[model samples]
Target: MTPLYQVSDSPAVVSKKYFSRRELMPSQNSSVWQIQSGSVRTMTYLDDGTIVTLGIWGAGDIVGSALSTIEPHIIECLSAVEAVALPLDRQNKMVEALAAHVEQAEELMVIRSYRTVDSMLLKLLGWLAKRFGRTVDNGQLIDLRLTNQDVAEILCSTRVTVSRVLTQFEDQGIIQRLPLHRIVLCNQETLRRAG
Candidate 1:
């Protein structure tokens, strides 16, 4: 099977650049950065300085300000990142990236549409587990290192509310919190059914 973002037989030589956590990725209209490791969240601020998360991108995913028309587009590293710049001249590859971006936005919109914060958060956790988690003995481990504030930004909720809900989830055995903002989705299937 072919990789999702495969390079051509004669690919351009591009060096992978490292970015620290919370670092802002450099944007170039002529190219996009393909993630080699770690993850990033693209965001834009409203007039009131409220952050709106656009999307979360992981390995093999492409991201850049050029992909969005939102002013002040920013890609903030969620973890230590390694990425290589891919020229936008590759239309086919960029098309795939754009499609993925659209799909993710749609999915996130659905999750956010849930009436209650608990329901929205539950679905968001499940989505993240599916996309970025690794299977563990008991459940999937989400190692995104996302803060309560980060999650709140994604869901358009308050940090206090997110913290409370996360605690509630832990108390209910729905999730297990680990260090460095990691979480184990203890019973994602049950949560999915309940939600």
Candidate 2:
């Protein structure tokens, strides 16, 4: 689908536009980067050796929203994903606009509270269900194509641990692995309980 910003620009505006129409322009200086599903991008490191997995942005989500203030970039995509690179000035403005929403501010607190790997995984699964789930004959099917290694990066855990947890869930009949890199939630209640 064409972005709203693209349709809003006039032909004259498009010709002299600082940002490309193909990119989702969050601000004037926005740039676009595209990636297929299942790729990795390196990230910046902290002095304390803490690695932050910003967010696994899917088809419609925006990236670099949180780190646009202090630094140019705080997180990098660990998988093949698209990122629209907004200039620092534009990013600052966007953050200010976002700050006005009380619900947006509260989301940061909720995200911060999931300090443990397991908690993060559970929370992420729940989020994916909400964002990209499709109702089928049996249950909700997660549309995001993710692997255990991808889960490890997002959850800040080893792949082994992620695999074990997934196996446990499968054994409990909470979810089932489908062909072509998909996962189906057999029972939402059971999955929530496991989480």
Candidate 3:
């Protein structure tokens, strides 16, 4: 697949760089960064200081000031991240990339809003596999490390519930944890029909 924002000779894009884990990228009002490798999560705290996971973006994803007016937001690396710090002025110029970002974000919101835990988790895995995973012998391997807490925040559920559902999935041979804490979908059909 073509990267959303490739390191181009075009004057509109420049300053491609890497970001370490937990490192802060440009803030909400700053220039947008297009993911070239790895993943990033942009989030904000509630008045109660609770952390919210706004979005998880991998290669080919574009994020930052152009995408949202999300205030009090922080962009942190979930893994070692490589991205192009796109010029803010050119943000609206990349119509296709912007549309992809908006569509993925909305899809995530709808998937996470499912009433049942099984439905939510299953849909999330399905979407993640499609968006981030690569093909493997058994199934798609989502190479990102999504912890219980991360799942909890995305699904608006408790960590314990996330853990329970994950364990259940593993027991049922629907999913498995791999090295680097990556998740592998063992049964694509089962996940698709779970909800």
Candidate 4:
């Protein structure tokens, strides 16, 4: 594993690396990048070239190709990101990260299993809201800057379908779309009723 940082004769200092949105993060053999801010999605391609999103990670989450056994693993920034490389030597930390990955995978699997795309997308929005949203005056606000294409990639659906559903959601007063791809879920009660 190549070291990401340079060693000097002075005190040790870990530097933060910045990544622009849609940029691919470097893979290391013996280390992982811990996100200091923003979010990223780890993914891989199938035999037929279908893209499979492994997981979405945010602040304080660790990501690296070394942690995955899948071939052609990649981590792509979902927003402007700041991260630091950390040696992958801590067993407990790795365990937690792996567990989170598995749990989220299962959650997404269930979300995609819904009979209708509308149901699936609604569930996905609720999950994203719970995971990455912040409290606003009206409800939870999801400001991940994810485009319809990005949501389609995560849901394993088509971008047109996702866009239509989002428009429908807005019309039904289930959510409010803001600039920069932000979404504000009306309320937990509305979500439960929609489901």
Candidate 5:
């Protein structure tokens, strides 16, 4: 990772106050930094007519891909958000980092393709278990704030189907749905087996 100061255009300025949600793009050669201080929703529009729910970026996760020969932005914030904006030069370095990151993300997508819809859900649960799980007294809880609609988009299924699958998971005690966009993973091993 590049040093934050080395990449910052204005190293002297750092805001303590959280930024509310907004969209941003690099100005000329500028790079924008978005830090999710807490849970926030996001939607990304692909070049195709399809839209993807990028889910929530928990605290300490960074958004914005700064590196690409062609402008690296294709994602947008879908709700009121909080983040930090950085200069373009620093963003360029971050883009280099993102290149490697994209490879891993793509690998995960490939894994998602090999399975049936039910398997996909289970795989997704497993992936989230590692990437975003928070240990609770009972089990690991996935911190991503996703609706069945969001899961449908990600899984390339209808919302109704996704909801049914989630219901099945709930019935099997594989997961627990909390109010306000939280999912509790009650049994990751069962989820893995189901997947």
Candidate 6:
């Protein structure tokens, strides 16, 4: 992964900070976090106390304690993370920073609106491939250590279901699991083929 310090123009990085795995970033008010390296997950509670994951943000992605104006959510570090806190304490930088990701936000909404779970997952794989995967001899390697539970949260499915679906994909030769939590898209063409 590229070091965050290598970036030449992120003035918001003055408050560069580090967080341990599973540590929660402040989530009480509206604030934007600029991820330098590593990843973070944001989640909210349902009326029945169920956890609904908002998103898994990686490098270059921006997140907030409560991104939605309607609900309060928690932002936690999924892995050891280095980021810059753009505390919305005084400036309208929050609005400007968030404006940078308008297109990413729209893409996520489209992916989430898919009617079928498999379709949604497939589209997500394609999206991730474009966002984070790299071409290799065997296939496209997604450079994120995403687990089934993490995927389930993003897809609003159970870990059991995510595991089953991913296994099924491997069985069909669409994807392969590498050591650790990495995934290789063995058949990108097949994955992108409309179902």
Best by lDDT: 1
**Candidate 1: residue pairs that collide:** none
How far is 187's C-alpha from truth in model 5 (Å)?
2.7
Model 1's number of clashes is: 0
Model 5 clash pairs are 20-81, 21-80, 21-81, 30-88, 31-87, 31-88, 33-84, 33-86, 67-95
**Tens-digit per-residue lDDT, 1-195, candidate 2:** 322222223453223222222233232225322222333322333333554443344444434433332122333434434343323333355445653352333333243346566555555666566557887766778878798898787656799988887787678676787876577777768446423
Candidate 6 structure lDDT: 0.71
- Cα lDDT for residue 195, model 3? 24
State in Å the error of residue 170, model 3. Answer: 0.6
Runs of candidate 2 exceeding 4 Å displacement: 1-116, 191-195
Q: Rank the candidates by TM-score, best first.
A: 1, 4, 3, 6, 5, 2
Against the true structure, candidate 5 reaches a TM-score of: 0.47
TM-score of each: 0.52, 0.42, 0.51, 0.52, 0.47, 0.49
lDDT of 3 by residue, 80-145 (tens): 999887655444456556756675675676566566787788878888887888989888898988
Task: Give lDDT tens digits, candidate 1, residues 9-88.
Answer: 45455657999999999997667899999999988764447677778999988888656655677899999999998766
Residue 152 deviation, candidate 3, in Å?
0.9
Model 6, residue pairs in steric clash: none
Q: Which stretches of candidate 5 lie over 4 Å from their true place?
A: 1-96, 191-195
| Candidate 4 clashes between residue pairs 3 or more apart in a chain or in different chains | none
- Encode model 6's per-residue lDDT on 85-139: one tens digit a residue: 7655424465545544653664566566666677777777877877888998877
List RMSD in Å for every model shown. 13.4, 13.5, 13.2, 13.6, 13.5, 13.5
Q: Provide the lowest-lDDT 10-residue window in model 3.
A: 87-96
- lDDT per prediction? 0.81, 0.50, 0.75, 0.80, 0.58, 0.71
Q: For residue 26, what is the lDDT in candidate 1?
A: 95
User: After aligning candidate 3 to the native by TM-score, how far in Å is the CA of 190 from where it should be?
Assistant: 2.9
